[model samples]
Target: MPHSPMEVTRLTATDAARAARVLDEMRASTLGGGRAKLAPRPAIRESWGRMLHNGIDPDHDFRTDLLSRDEVERRRQTSRLRHTLPVLREGLLSLADTAQHIMLVADADGRVLWREGSASVLRKADGQGLGVGADWREETVGTNGIGTPLVSRRPVQVYSSEHFVRALHSWTCTGAPITDPRDGSLLGVVDVSGPLETLHPCTLALVDSVAKLAQARLRDLHLTSLEQLRAVAAPVLARMDGRAVAVDKNGWTAAVTGMPYTNRLALPKSLAPGRCWLPALGLCSVEPLPGGWLIHPTGDPEPPLTAPHILLDVSHPRRWTVTVSGQTGSWTHELTPRHAELLYLLALHRDGRSASTLADDMFGDPARTVTVRAEMSRVRRYLGAFLDHRPYRFTEGAEVEVLLPEAPLDLLPHSVAPGVVRARAAAGGQAWVERAQR
Candidate 1:
């Protein structure tokens, strides 16, 4: 039925006639209100054999082999949807520079999580196919991207009339499924809808980019949940993420910070910007830093690279802050909303809160423990980037706390500060977090 080169050769005249006769008779049976079994009924075949005064040719046939287009479409959908998180609505307002319609995120049972973009554009988009609370799966609404991708566990671009819904002929959608890497499960989907005429190859990529950004953010949540890290300061900063038992030269976690959580999580850029701690390398190594332990031929001899065992040595309980450099952003310039959020959080809780406690008191929607750990890490990373007296870098067995800025509201955006709240409950509790209400 699709327009592909994978068609079979045409049937010969005699065969075509026979096919016509079979189909005509089948149609007549239905029209005349008589049931005609297509199987070899002796009388039916005899009648057709006689009616076909012309001899039937064996050459006539129809082609059926296809190039497995389903796989092509399926893989595309899977890849696109794999990592994107649905962008949640924060306030009553929507973001600028997007379709004028609202997009919703839902679980398998069709419960809405988040939705926002352009309300006017969304209303028109709804007419094309999607609508508030409407399911978009192949089973429920047809072979469109969002619902079908969710069902199929992939990214999908349902185009033109491929949709099963007659009301969706004018629509096309590109959708990708969001996934949680810590446990490797489907979180939901992110989809973009627009007119078929405006479709371009970049369209899907944009949706894919958003998904990746969201996934990156999601992964950050996971990292923030890991409250402890093996901060071994050798030639290279080795951040070993084994059980506390495997820490130190003896490989025994004799001293542990009871803030219990997982060890292995993604490394956020804020924590290790220019440096990468390779777990496979066994030995750690530092890079060419600006100027610390410099050995200039003409200048005084610089201090030797700090020893790795310093982290475990009781004589030096505080490991020298390994200055992994090159994190440059809003600190030298203006602060972003996220910058404000991090600064606010750090400012509010000068005393380090446990990763779990931070999730409980600071955020409105609760991320999984893994996600929470990553966000905490992000919170720390962001503070390190902006604040003059950035608090603790990262270590296991203890909570990190930052001293709030003296000018409390300095982190808030001068323009939008009044409209924003200082903090909200985590795990999707605020009025804005509840999508169905919107």
Candidate 2:
């Protein structure tokens, strides 16, 4: 039986050398196709499996070409992480320096964008190819802090022999992913790394804490931007008549008139001033505002003469989108993870589902109908009448097509919803059967 991750952490902090030896033995036995006296932690074990499947050599260090200096600068300038640098530095740098650990910030793709902290640790990291502009994806560097957290979408710590690659076994690293507060999209990862002797169980918690503070900073900045946009939109919206809304670029509403105010309005990827079909507002005239847009219903019952076609694409591992097409125009909205799961479930059961049923499917608790209903309400605002709420389903006559991932297991990989889990299992089994028959 595997010792729990907590037990491993306690042992590592008190007797790192012994813990390292145990982990090394476990790694060797497992990688050598034999059962070990103890099993690796689930995260480490899963990562090792991926490394084996991807043919990442455990004994060799594979390095990709680092990005050019100019490219690194460009990424820093454009990344939203730049805004939270102060928060990250204030919260983590001093502690990291004192602990002889170097702090690193990597973009969502696992390219190291910033590296700082102890000068000695910086030199050590340089010798190990952990410098700025280096690619640290799991596929590129095997199992480590930065890449693993990006894949797992959570904080992770890799210590000593827990690393899949032998070269990285001498290093200890902890990382936490930072996501955009506005849309819940991943921004990047912040990590603390040092030599194996510096391993500490608290490193993961500290890094995770700082990462959350950075997210809070980003959330504050987003709210400030929304306020500024609201100020600019107030006068424009005040003069407007009949169901109109002023929304920021990300579809966050600043103000609304002649209709119930919604927190957001689903806008298309490419928007312009003229007649456009919006999700909630139906046919609307859209005009650019100073910081956002002014949209009003054009008073047409249906979009021109064509029924809407909806496409829900959950093929991508991290990003999901819903596209609506009509005679007037076509628009696509990137979906948050929860919305993606709900839409996928609805697509699966076109007949419809009760709120309680959806709750049970999503949370494994039938009594959580309130939570399901609230999320569904938000979905309806963006989906408009295409979604029917009596039982909750796509409109009967409308064409609803779902684009799924080529690999069943890749579908909504981050989702823990029971429906998605069951779907993945069923689909994987079916795929295995098909392959066997062929």
> For residues 1-438, what per-residue lDDT tens digits would candidate 2 score against the true structure?
326567777888778778788788877777776766666665676567557656788888656789999999999999999998999999888877888888899999999999999999898778877789999988899889988888767788898887888988878889999999988888889999887667777788889999999999998998999889888888877887778888988889988888998787777878889987776677888889877888889888874535779999998767889988777667788888899999999999999999999998899999999999999988887786688887999988779899998766457866668888789768762343222223
Model 2 pairs whose backbones collide = none
In candidate 1, which residue ranges exceed 4 Å CA deviation? 1-102, 125-130, 228-438
Return the TM-score for each candidate structure. 0.33, 0.90
Instruction: Name the Cα RMSD for model 1.
Output: 24.5
Model 1: per-residue lDDT, tens digit, 1-438?
111111100211124333334434443442234553332222222212222222322122211122244543454355423234333232112322243334455544332334456656566754443444444433345445565555445455554433434355455566666666553445667766554443444545666556656767766654543323223222222233332221221111212322243232222222222323322111122222221110101122332322211111111111111122221111111222333344445445555445455444335444444555655454443233222222322323223333222222212212122212343223121222122112
C-alpha lDDT (0 to 100) for residue 8 of candidate 2: 70
Candidate 2 weakest lDDT stretch, 10 residues:
429-438
lDDT of each: 0.36, 0.83
State residue 379's C-alpha deviation in candidate 2, in Å: 1.7
